[model samples]
Target: MNRSNGGAPHRSITAGTDFLHLAIEEAPGGGKSDWLASRIRLALADGRLPMGSRLPATRVLAGELGVSRGVVTEAYQRLIEDGHLAGRGRNGTIVVGAPAAAPKSPARTAPPLPRSVFAAAPGTDVFDTMRTARARIDLSPGLPDLAAFPRAAWLRTERHVLDHLAASDLGYGDPRGTPALRRAIANWIARNRGIRADPDEVLIVAGTAQTLTLLGRVLRDDGITAVAVEDPGSLGARQHLHNCRLATPPVAVDSEGIRVDELRATGEAAVLLTPAHQFPTGVVLRGSRRSELTRWAREGGGLIIEDDYDAEHRYDRTPVPALRSVLTENVAYAGSVSKLLAPALRIGWVLAPPRYRDALVDAKRFTDLGNAALPQLVLAHFMESGAMERQLRHLRRHHRHRRDAMIKAIGTHLPSAIVHGAAAGLHLTITFDAEFADTELAAMALARDVKVHPLSWHSQRAHRPGLVLGYAASTPSDIGEGVETLGEVLRRGGAGPGFVR
Candidate 1:
């Protein structure tokens, strides 16, 4: 009698398949199919073979395991009968179901975030927390029409860059940024904002946030202890400066933008400003005030950190030249695509005065080895190819319509509310004569699943009760509905006395 006919393996021999490492020697005498089925079930229970995973062909697995085809076929049939898998003709077997998963331990789960995030003074992580909070409508400021991101144009430019990329381009890039993107940024600001700069003057950063961070460090190192910020300025920017251990002495902002007089009164060596389009307030720096600010920077020896954010998103006015254009020696200008494009790109540029230029570059060199080279190259191509200009024109048209719809809705619903910053930027600030806290209104609105920032969150001084509502990211219908909901919330006395909805 031949042992081959009986299919009994010798004690010295063993057979195994790569599919789950199935071993014929591990099967009981004359129970190969049973053992194989048990192994698959174990794999399913432990999540090794997840749902929708395709199994190897029975014939191929059988050959690998040195088993007869019938054994593999029978094993597959067992799993099929158990509803763990299904077979498609010529498509091989696939996992169609998995065993119920074991329950996770209570200790392994994260605790829910507190709902009091909007109740008190917002911490540094407040924005991070709010972003993750659940809500039906997000009217958060500092966001553009994210849905309008030019994916096709970006992809086309990305592909073009990749096709023509040099092998050396993949290595470590310039800590300051790629020359292509720097040149593109230089030309971009020149044409759009009237700022003259060489590509070498541009230092690509993560975003305006990083610009503040790096500047804060460099300023502090240079014996600067304070940077005066607009009273109703960006709380996030103020927080960034504060985190860098710099005191943010608040300077009042009136209709003429930041008060140059009060900024000088602060006696700080440097000041941060949103001059072209002031954050939250949306007031443009007037000509006289601009001149005064220039005099302060040039004559008073005060450094100006100009955040030229959202200068290109104007609707009802001609563009204002960036402060860097006239006070190039005293001003450090920063801009980013966060307001123009989406913030997710994490791309921005800083043009510091020659005094601080080397320090900023050194700070960037040690921080993340510069932004990823591919995106820098792609964005450079996008801007150089005139695609960014076209995108800006398209965003202006789209944002204008949304801004109009929001103004209309505010008028129809909250007639008593005073809307500010409507002339430009992605958001509008509406103030109320009510005595209630804006944080209370924000919390109430959040309770109704509408997200917004309390005006007080952006103001460090005593300011009017208001809310900052963004229109650029939402549809007309959503904006209308969100404003209507806010109206309803106010009518319910959420805004306290003197508020008329």
Candidate 2:
């Protein structure tokens, strides 16, 4: 085993070193040490002898190389003197540093989304692009006070859950949701939104976006080809419906909420609405409008997909009950923690009409098996412990401060801007009675390191130029600065009459 070569004539010995099979050779001259040092240098340059790699013992290498210990020791000393290796006494000789590397070309990276993306109605990548855009302050709507996530309470609940969880609980959960979360949601909505639902009736989904998708599929299969949507409604929601191959017909929404007569005129048997607090506009469905809608639904055998988003964040308005509270048979209600906690937790609940509950559950079963079960348990625990209620209270006070700051700033800065949906929700939409392009203003704001959404992106018909700004995610100072900047931009580029209402 010790004899490496055939030993027929003679061969220069090569070391069986542990340094990735490094070998040693003595040439015609006394050059073994030089070859050893050169190899070590090359390995260091190539990162094989990275910093902290311990070299093999000198005695072992010398024996393997059939060279004197002095040769190995001399080579190690040369590396140490050159500052590439260091001796650690009994530990071993270790690589200390490496040779300077040559400069390399910069790596390729994707270009930023063109500002033209915001010039028209937003596409699938619009939200992603806006999120990734570099901004000093982001006032784009549809986010809550993410900085106030109850991490401490969540950890406490998580630990408690883990300690009590059975092996089966960690396995694939029912698509309808864990009994624990469904029960918690049943209790939650009943208590908060005045809607009572059985635990089995609540189908857990991956937030409102997925809820829309699943509903679209079931509704289409039910021979409902078209679902009427509120004009100037959520562009994201409209996109979700359109993606599922459903025709989204627009109905006009005035200050009080959706015009039921116009909705009746659309001839659509199904409709999607944000009645608790309308998206972007924040108008609660009027008492008369709600009654009229329920009457229409009962008469036409229609379905209402109620997006009960951000209704819990009310500051100055009387709490409007969710449509599902009264119109249980016709309304399919959806709500999520995206606005309450964070969008990162893609967890939401959908309570369908009895006729479609089973079908929706099956779609959810095949969609992703189910939302990760552990988060559902954590949320259930969080809700039962009253942490969610406390969080809402905290968010209301915090968001109200930012909202007040924004209103004051707008009044002082852009006095001609009409602020809509200020009494509730995380954001306020302001429309300017001007002819300039809101999309151009949004692009200009992004260029100045501020991010905001143009209102035209959410509208299907001609309307005054507007902007939807979120204050809940930012500090009062940021809100003020952002509104002031908007005013400045407007002043520089076709300053329209600004009125703060």
Candidate 3:
């Protein structure tokens, strides 16, 4: 058989007699395994079975062909050795990497909520739409352990806040978020991030999205319309900037961090960055990049809108100092308890340069009259009572376990793939070498009920295909199973590595 070039046509048999016609009978216990392997090779070559087509289990096919299980096993082993088939954990044996044009048998489709679902409208409720999209399994990123949310602790705090709540306290509180929360956040940042800020500079807003919206409006009003962003950055952040009618100029990011020279070249008045640990790539903005960016900020008369997202989950490296701590005036620093505590709290802090502080506070004042008061106060109590820090410690241990599991699973199943950004944060970026689209692979994965963010979604420039998988919210077994399913999909030519689905 010519393995490199296309072979002859597949044998088209109607039913039982056809399989029997191709089947070789064991004679005097001669080499059944070698015979079976030869038959399989011919079948694969002639297109009798296609790529991604699931083979019958070893014992079942052995019984049907009236052969010993070892004969079937040996045949499978030979094909596996030749890179035609793979053992897909619980997914069973599947043909993975086959020639795109050389195929025969058809297969079932993913249940529903197809890949088109991700392209839905980007409005106020887009996130809700995404969360509700049904899949066989959900691997959406940026979620904490919803199952581990401190229900008892929350109830106790809620009751305490309500008991102490006077009728007047329920009315409109400070537009700069609740004083209690601002003070709490100030203290928290001082202790954890090494940034000391007057509570006056800390304006509470609704998570990072609102922080972007408010900043976008305030910056635009200040005659700054474009903000440079890191290449292969957060898709959600880019969308938020676009939603506020702001241009996001793309800046290249390298090993150290966002290219400061490129940022200066763009001449954009402001830039948004995830410098602590960059989004998909996971590289921290090291000393050189930090110093370069600081100098650029001082020289360019620009602003750095820092999205200090998920800075608390470092494993292999020491925690890097926040940009706000380094150049407080130039960096409009924002952070939330979303990754640390929960996103549902809808509470985040922003430290703006003195020039934009009043306008940002005004935007917050008009934007839903500031974030709700009770959650802010309860979070304050949580921070003061040490529950927040305790929760972070708990998440660190849990997330570390999941991250290790995912790395191990990738090593075993998809050894060809390179893993990035596994040291910190809840997700890891995995890239592979193939001509096929990653989006198509993601679509196939979705069809199989596994959801992953296509790396293309985060990149504005041409780049390699990959997936950003979050490990924080899921259990270790779930992470392994999800990645295994992805491996099976890749092998089957449902989608090739490096191609966007």
Candidate 4:
């Protein structure tokens, strides 16, 4: 019998096991089982061996460590008794328990956002801060009914895609986008937005925000300095352009959409417009204004960036054709599922003029190497299968009930406030005739746990004080409570003497 091996190895200076680099040398002469149990406990505490991870067999590990079988068996038995592992007979040992994670240090925790965020002039991070701020009732615009996201449909589509996905398809995809999604988008836009485009011409992007950033870079390279934006337009969009060092000269927007004459007067070669349903105001661009805008683009060599957001959520009005449908040569059309499905998807498409198409693709290549391939494929299938159409129809019916609820609440509680853009879209804009700071009202309402966007935040020039309130995500009961709370806040703060009826 090899009596020396029963105690310890004399010839080897360093005996070790390959699994988790377990070193037998680190154990005391008679404490091998204790050291092994300690190392395993540490591994479990630090998450190296998570629950359900299969461990090496006692015999195999004993051979690897040049230890007797009984030594390894004793060590595993200790962990099994401690409930950190379980013996599964032929399945070997499996990790069954782990220590609770240590609490984070106070220094590592982020401080709560300050209320002054609403008081200060809107900055690039203003929206980011407001989103993180605590609130019980959020009426922030530009959000759809997120609770209604089609999780079942998405999961089913995702499973089908993964089941049929090729190994090669997992590699880097086309910078332009997957051809399946491009073709699907072409068909989708033609049917819904009235924009007929070749699948080859479509460029997939992260969202409308990325669309602005990429276009800003490309337009700068092409020697364009400034892009006019509608006054009281999307402040977030304006901020993206400003971050790219492009000046956003303000052009007034009225009931008929952006003032093309004011846009031309700015002397900027390019303009960004949300014509289908203008932000905050929610007015459609009249046909005559569309003609003037087209003439500006064709005759004056202007570029139009059409943001067709939320056009699919109409309640009362007929569908408006996308601007890209009319002016193919100079219009750069952008649309996203942010308003249709959820903003978390970050999927949008861009159709640029022939001159900017190639440059835009190159910009996309360097920006993030194109959007993820699988989601594009999944969305493509969802659209082609008529699931997207079904989703739209469902959202239309669901949102209409909530919209009507909000309208009724406003009429009952805030009758003095005049509402705009209620015929279609996810939100309504209400303006007060009397003078008061809308931001102050918003801050006070937020203090009562109600969140809203001050209308002045979107405007570069003077405008009537208002609030943009979204109803799509809230239940009818909550909508009623929130509007009633706003009325209570208004009465307590004595907003503008009294809101004009």
Candidate 5:
């Protein structure tokens, strides 16, 4: 049997297992570490060890290779200091970059979530990638105070639910939702949103994304061809509607809310509105406009799909009642705990008009049978036990503090920018008097590890350039620093229609 100088089987030592199958030969004049590092670098360059691949622990790899752990550690440290790898706490060492002079990726495309899938050009798909991109500070709008999620309350309620649950409860549930959650949500809307409905009338769907898809199907089956949306509306929502094959004609939004007259001119039978707090602009539907919208819906047999996003996250204003509360005949009201609690819980309810109620339920029943039963029951417990109310109170105080910080930062750093939608919701939009492409501003900010949404991304028509900055998810320090960095990038004259590719 052949044995190495270390008195081990040569086959097991040289061809033995190691991360990336890197083997060490009998130590040459340069030593085992040098041999190991060379093989690793070669593997990285030749694609045997791909990016994001995690290296084995030093002790484990050393044992397998019949070498001292110091050899493995030395090899890893050399690669790390060279910027080819990084040691993430609790995640072990991962390959972060390839060896220098290795082939680079093809020129990167624009950031994600633009209008079309047209090109490597900025569109919805690319915009989505941007959302997932790592950043040191996140100021993307539509996020709540996620750090304040009631983990203890949720656990207590979930434990109680599991203790009392029947084995059958673990099986497939009602497609509409669990009875307990529907009843709890009904009570929630009655008290908070001012909408009264039987638990049966409340159809629990996924988040608003699925809500739009379901409504699109139901409306099309009802011979409705078009749905009017606010011009500076939600790009994500628009993409959803378009995916469902519905025509989304644009209606202008003003200081008060969506222009009701322009909506009527669109001749669409349905309209999606974020009446409580308009997206991007943060404008609430004023009383006069609310009446006009209701009148338009009632007269033309049009449907009002009220997306009550960020409705409960109010500051510097009284509550705005849900449109479905006043005009239940035409408004299909939807509300989710996404902003109030956390979006990971894809639980929301829809109180649709009587005409579409049964059909919508049928569509839901065919979709996924229903959301999981355990989470729904746990949510019901949270609602009935008043934990959600306590959470809301705590979030209000914390978010208010962060919002103040964001406003101050904007005043200090982006003084020339006009802020919009600051009174309510997690985000505020700022438009500039100086000419520059908002997307380029957003891209530069992102390069500095600050995330934001360009105003043009949300608008359907030509509009002034602006940036939508979210404040609730970040600490006050992060928010201020992020905005300051944005100002620095703007001062560097990097604002334009093109991005840093």
Candidate 6:
């Protein structure tokens, strides 16, 4: 049995002493310490240094390798200094969590399992499984600053709301959410998003996901089979629409924004858009395009589903008012606190056109009977008390700094890349003019343990090779490290060519 003294494996002397199986080279005469460090780094890069894995003591490893203890000590010290390893008092040296391990090619004894969205007896937890799939560092878009969640403020609000509520109020409130939340939402839209809405016009639902689901049901019932979506737009949104059985026609988006000309050509009854800050590409609808789209909505009698996502988190530009604020009758407007607050809250309000208001409320009533009452009351308190606005002010400063860090890192690491939509929002879309497939690159990135959304993943129509990276949830250091790792991945010609499975 090996007596692990915390640094190295206390096994019998073998021909190999490192992860790369680097045999001692007598011809080189020295530099074993450097070789040891390199081997450890490679092991880490390839995921051999899994989280919480104990390392053999320096003395034990030195004895096994027939080398001095100083060599192993120096090598281990380097990793410790680099945040890759941590020393546990009596427990010894341990590998802390890092990126995921690269996939190893399947051998004859172990064939790789096939992956698909639809398989018989599908995995019980698809969402959790997808999240667990390897990535070196995740650059996925849309995540907010999770670490900065206003826990204290939320607790205070919860306590305040609970204190005032009577026991009778707990026994199932209105299905359209608490009337208080609807009134507060009305005030919120009028103040922040520029939409002058009445409390009765507001129908509270879960987040935008439920909004799309209900809208899908209502539109389908009304015989509207297709809703045109911006090309290279939100994949999650498109998938949600598809899940609701609504056919999504891919419409092209240019610098000014989604091609209204192409949209008109489709002759669809309705269109879903991220007009304030378009997703994935980050291009705002220009003056001309906005006018043209409004004209199309007016003349063609097509309804517009304006998802004013990420409109409140702007920096370096004046706020753009929601299109619904301009033409309330033609637009079905929706906004959620998912990005602003937390998606876990599942609290948002929708303002449908007069014709669809009652239908949407009915749809919401039948399907979950309104969001939780207490939470809605608390949220109402949050908005009416102006706590939500203060929180936004705090996030703006924090998010701006994080965004700048990511941009600077990209400049320093991947100079060939172009950043999109840095003027506002919690994430940035970066594209590279490389001679490689974004999907393969994304898979390779995942193989290397960094998570990112391939630009192609969002595109129904063709788009350039790129990745959508979210900086809001990560520290500046993590963003820099993640981008640097991505640069290394690119420099190495995809994700470590031969080592990946």
Q: Write the number of the candidate with greater TM-score, choosing between 3 and 5.
A: 5
Candidate 2 C-alpha RMSD relative to the actual structure: 17.5
**Per-residue lDDT of 179-244 in model 1, one digit per residue for the tens?**
999999999999999999999999999999999999999998999999999989898898899899
Candidate 2 to truth, TM: 0.75
Candidate 4 wrong stretches, greater than 4 Å: 1-117, 124-131, 494-501
Better of 3 and 4 by TM-score: 4
Model 2: ten consecutive residues of lowest lDDT: 3-12
| Candidate 4 local distance difference test against the native | 0.83
User: On a 0 to 1 TM-score scale, where does candidate 4 land against the true structure?
Assistant: 0.75
Higher-ranked by lDDT: 1 or 5: 1
Over the full model, what C-alpha lDDT does candidate 2 score relative to the true structure?
Answer: 0.82
Clashes of each: 0, 7, 14, 0, 7, 14
> Each model's TM-score?
0.75, 0.75, 0.75, 0.75, 0.75, 0.75
Each model's lDDT: 0.83, 0.82, 0.77, 0.83, 0.80, 0.78
What is candidate 3's local distance difference test score? 0.77
TM-score of candidate 6 versus the correct structure, residues matched by position: 0.75
Tens-place lDDT digits, model 4, residues 172-288:
989989999999999999999999999999999999999999999999999998999998888889889999999999999988988988887888999999898898799999999
After TM-score superposition, the amount by which residue 117's alpha carbon in candidate 3 deviates from its true location, in angstroms, is: 7.7
Q: Give the local distance difference test score of model 5.
A: 0.80
